[model samples]
Target: MRILLVDDHAIVRTGLRKLLAMVSNAEILEAKTGRESLAIAKAQPLDMIILDLNLPELGGLELLSRLRQFGPAPILVLSMHSEPIYVTRALEAGAQGYMSKNASPDELLTAIRQVSGGGRYIEQEIAQALILQSAVPAASLAQLAPRDLEILRHLAAGRSLSEIAEALGLGYKTIANNCSLIKTKLGVTKTADLLRLALEAGVS
Candidate 1:
């Protein structure tokens, strides 16, 4: 198996490399940034991709869409966020599997096997959460795209539009426009209300 590990943390990559060694005949490639991962994906064929959502410049959700244009390789998102919103956006972005960072090594291997074999997998706890969340009335958070969610998360963290633009490598005007769109979608007239909603939704 030819697998690419996309994560910015050296320790996490090292741990995953060691864990993936359990897969027979597995060859691993690593990238610490979204740009590097895109370059590697474009330059080679991969059997599977293990991606992390919290990349340096390019967010993982956006990267998932871009990577899908490269090949048929299945993507398994390994993220710290186990929220249903995160899982929903990832699946919508074309991920074959979603596993929280809290998953056991055994579960990680199972997720890798399933997704690489053209099957879908989600962490047990997260799957349950998704089910419960689905039972509730859909809200504006469900209407937000992955990028919009990222912006809301940053806003909940008390980041200004300028800071968010810098972090996302977008223009300030773009971020401001997105914030307005987010407000419209969420039915809020004020940024403070948006921040409150984001916090209530556990974005921070």
Candidate 2:
């Protein structure tokens, strides 16, 4: 099996590499950035992609959408984010499976096997959360795209618009426009309200 591992952390990639060795004769490829992973996926034939949500240049959900455009390999999101919102968005973006980093190695292997076999998998706890979330009112936060959510998270972390633009590799005007759009979507008129919404959603 040829599996591409996408993560920015070297230590995490090293650990995942060792864990993936359990797959018989598995050939693992590594990428430390979203751009690098997208290039690899476009250039190489891969059986599966194990992706992390936190990435440079591109957010994980956006990367998954682009990968689905041409890359046929099934994507399994292996992320530190275990929130139902994150999980639901990833699956909506084309991930075949979603597993938290806190999952046991055994569960990780199980997710890999299930996804590689053309089946879907979600961490048990996340699946339950999704079910519960469906029983309640869907927040406007759920309407935001992955990048928008990322921007909101940065805002909630106390980043200025310029700082967010630099961190996201975008222009200041673009960030400002996005903030305007986000405000419209959430029915807020001030940055403070956006921050409050982000905090309430646990996006930070």
Candidate 3:
């Protein structure tokens, strides 16, 4: 099987390559950012993709959505963020599996194999957390106003406040106010915390 490994870190790609060598007949392609990953995906026929959530040019969930727009491929997210929110968003964005970077090599091998075989995979802890969250029937995560949602999406895509304002045709002050409101509603004290909350809630 052919796999694409999308991560900014060379060491991470190398480690994954070494681990997968033991489990499957896999030829790996590497890309450092989401833009490069999309270009590579367009040019190659890959059986699966091991993606990192914290990409430089684009967030992993956004990349997953873009990839799905063209075709369906098993995307197994291998990320450092183990929060249930990140896993749920990855899955909702069309990822076939979600595993933490802290996972054992055997666990990653199992995830890759399962996802490549057209099955869904999630870490045991994350899976249990999702199940528990489902039982609570809490308010929707997209509770922000339309402007806040737009800002959240841009933030999730790794855009700065000024960039988001420019892209959305809004004034910098207006965008800042909206962001402040979003943080208040989400009960987050900082942009990074808001991002974490948005990812968990699967806002985009």
Candidate 4:
């Protein structure tokens, strides 16, 4: 199998190349930045791409969206962050699979194989963690409007009310009110509890 290993670290590429080679006769190509990755992918067809989200030049999500235009190769995101927001964003941005860097080597191979086979994979631990966070009543999360959910995600990331307001282009009072309502709907009395709930839900 042919695979592209996109990471900024030379040691990381070397380690991944060695591991991937052991799993299969993979012709692994490495890229240090998003531009190089795109160039190599456009030049020839790749069977899969294992990507790191914290790239140097280009943003990982933007690169992911652009890579979707190149071909049908599944993009497997290998990230250090197991936060809900990170996982959610990667999947939402078109990742075929998501695995935390802390995953076992065997799990890594399984995720790659599943993604290559046109199936989705999420690290078992991460999946279970997210599931447990979903212990809120049935449709409890479903009750949230998309905007409220988005706000919740920002909150879980430790963003201040003003920061979230600025980022969302809403007023401070508006965001404060929204947070109040979110806390009420979530049945949490404290800001910390709301944030904890959001994190449990894999918001970040």
lDDT of each: 0.89, 0.86, 0.77, 0.81
Best by TM-score: 2
lDDT of 1 by residue, 63-147 (tens): 9999999999999999998877778888989999999999999999999999999999999999998888742323658788778
Candidate 3, 177: how far from true, in Å?
7.2
Ten consecutive residues with minimal summed lDDT in candidate 4? 133-142
Considering only N, C-alpha and C atoms within 3 Å, which residue pairs clash in candidate 4? 84-202, 85-203, 85-204
- How many clashing pairs per prediction, in order? 0, 0, 1, 3
**Model 4's lDDT to the true fold?**
0.81
Model number with the top lDDT = 1
Q: Against the true structure, what is each candidate's TM-score?
A: 0.92, 0.93, 0.73, 0.67
Q: Residue 199: error of model 3 in Å? A: 11
RMSD of 1: 1.7
Name the 10 consecutive residues with the lowest summed lDDT in model 1: 131-140
lDDT of 3 by residue, 1-204 (tens): 788999999999998888888776678899999889899888877888899877664667677888776556789998877655566666777898999888888788888889999999998877876777642212444354434555786798898889987866678998899888887887778888888766656544
Cα displacement (Å) at residue 20, model 3: 1.2
In model 3, the runs with Cα more than 4 Å from the true position are: 134-140, 143-204
Over 1-204, each residue of candidate 4 has an lDDT whose tens digit, in order, gives 789999989998998998887878988899999889999999999999999876765656668878888999999999877865556667877899999889999999899999998999999887876666544532455556546766776787788998988766679999899988988898888999887766656565
Model 4 ranges off by over 4 Å: 134-204
